[model samples]
Target: MSPPKETNNKINTAKSSDGTIVKAGPIVKREKVILHIDGDAFFVGVEIAKNPKLRGLPVVTGEERGIVSALSYEAKALGITRGMPIFRVKREFPKVKILPGDYHSYVEYSTKMFDIVRRYVDDVEEYSIDECFGELTGLDKPLGMSYRQIAERIKKEVNEELDLSVSIGLAPTKVLAKVASNWVKPNGLTVIESALAVDFLQKVPIKKIWGIGPRTAELLNRKDIMTAKDFYDKDIAWIKLILSKPYETIWQELHGISVMEIDSAPKTVYSSVQKTRSFHPSTNDKTFLWSQLSKHIEDSCRKARHFNLVPRKFSIFLKTKDFEFVTALILLPSPSNSPEILLPLAHAHFENIHKKGVLYRTTGVTLLDLMADFVPQDDLFGSNAQASKFETIHKQIDLLEEKFGKIVIYLGSTKNAIDHKAQDGGTDSEDLDKNLLFL
Candidate 1:
């Protein structure tokens, strides 16, 4: 853009801590040190990080059910994406090395990179395993350098440690930084002046901004609003009519708004949550449903833990091949560590939703009525005389798992999926929380 911003007049010189001269790009006027790093072809990058041999070769990972979880740039250049069928990926990129998703590897890289980032910024938000946002507030210590200085260091650090490249985008607002980061991708930094954000976005297509997907772009296109600038200073009612959903946020982002209003406060309400499984279809045995639920419970709790929130009640819901749906939420005395205690609770709900002889193709478990963990609630006493002892054992199990590892514990009833994975030790999915991987 603008002849890549001329810098031929300035002589650049530096050592890369390796006694090597660093060739520099043009001098850019960077305003805010809001750094965004997005790992290029992330899951594939992880595969290469773990086994360098996987580099250069096209690699695709997912399940035998034929879903593409992640693709190397080589595969992507051939037109593959997250949910494309694996069979087509194979047919298209025949040279590609197809493997089941190594989610664990992705998790490790995600954790390690952030551990490094936390050293520099106080507010580092992990948006996903492959992307993150960092904010630089004080001009106090490394206080003197331009915003570009911080972004360059971050880019170099991540590349060196992760053996992968990440594009950095810098600006005043999160939205602008996010857009700038995407400007020059696959290992580059692009910074837009805070003042010029509106003008800059006008030159870029509407689809370039986040949240505006294909469907949104098509709608905007029909209205002759093809770029971010097209939406700027436009009638609010027109945008509301056009967007239909998330209109306000879309308008603000287009105007260079930094704070993510919805995420800024981070709602704690556990309105409802659902997890689904795409099975092999061969193993539709009614019993296999428990494995899916165990995974769902584990994942839901992890999300609950992340928000520092917990649920006082749980609900189990299911869908069948016939298109029927059913759900139930069992109230618990106190918030539990996970829904492992809710196996029976889920079972009770299922009994109500279960339709006999209905060949169910898909199923889900939902948890709702969430409350902050601090809120007190009563226990669900059992019918047996040893009910008190049962409750104590359950609490003890949670403590042990919390102190040691989740594998250091087990629940007899829901042990099917949980135990199998733990006993096998580490698979690619092991990198994610057991529940998340399973879900």
Candidate 2:
């Protein structure tokens, strides 16, 4: 890949609110305000928000033998860590609440959180289900408050409205904002102003810098850059020689420069998409196993369509109760995300891997070698032309499902998986009404 375009080294001056002339490198730096908001122990917080009695008690989320997905601060204080199995937690902290994850409620709270942030800043990036970044650079005059004050108010409003604790960080760059936010936890607020940027860097390890993973951290350690301050103190010429363009941008951001902007749009491209699920009891029923694979394919296709992408290859795998895997891979007749074209191929390949009397516990499907949905492909004719018809019908079905709810209209083959999910405590109340239609 080509290297990132180099920026000039010219310095520029700007007037601060105090009318003091401030100088910055490369780009003319104004008071570039970026705020990051992170929900504290998100899934556990949601459970606590739903049931106030759970407050101050050790709470964890995950069920059906899955590892711990989330834990409350109280649970953390009690020496409970994430990814610890539920059965062990039961054996250890028997009083902790280990409820099944309510994904629907989590999504609801996430939407509410984003809605609250949007009220204050138009440029809001939903970084994750529990994190968001909002731009407040030019809003100080109109909002009648400083950037720090705006961040403080947002934290207060989220707490009062959602009853969930959130830690917030304000900085001139997105990377610094993320660092500041993580520095404080359980409803703390931190600000990394340009004047105080070096102080913050000096206190953090190089590994703690946003975007610096273990491999990069080790590389920097070899150069004796143990702290964020050490990395920041590197010469620009050496940084360009040692690190890639992305690292160079982070280096600049550490110095209180805004090289990265908040991206608010949903991701439209992916290298691959996968869906998987395990049922309560293992089954050897061939039809039931195929149904599960069908459902996974349908779900993967749905996500591909949401991103306007198409896959050229698809694969399926089934895990046996004895901890053995049966897998198959096939190149598609055409690069497509329409379930109609892909499901038949999935079933055809499954035939090669299905072993009689081998009870399977889980099934999964992955769409790979993805490309833009609109990319040109070989012209369809006769039997191949039917794919176009299927595409149009599935597009309509997608819109209807988006409006009404998923499974309101679905493939007949997936009905068995839906029924199995309902019987095994997988389907929630919202899905029950429409799933009954298939019966």
Clashes of 1: 5
User: Could you tell me the lDDT of residue 272 within candidate 2?
Assistant: 95
Compared with the true structure, the alpha-carbon lDDT of candidate 2 equals 0.82
* lDDT string, candidate 2, 150-267, tens digits: 7777888889899988988878899988987887777877776766678778989999998999999999999899999999999778999998989999988988878898988865
lDDT of 1 by residue, 104-194 (tens): 7788988888777666666788887888888764442464665567667777887888897787776666777788777666776776654
> What lDDT does candidate 1 reach at residue 357?
69
Off by over 4 Å in 2: 1-31, 236-243, 266-272, 278-291, 306-309, 312-333, 347-363, 368-381, 395-404, 408-423, 427-439
The total of clashing pairs for model 2 equals 0
Q: Report the lDDT of model 1 for residue 331.
A: 86
Please tell me which predicted candidate would have the highest lDDT against the true structure.
Answer: 2
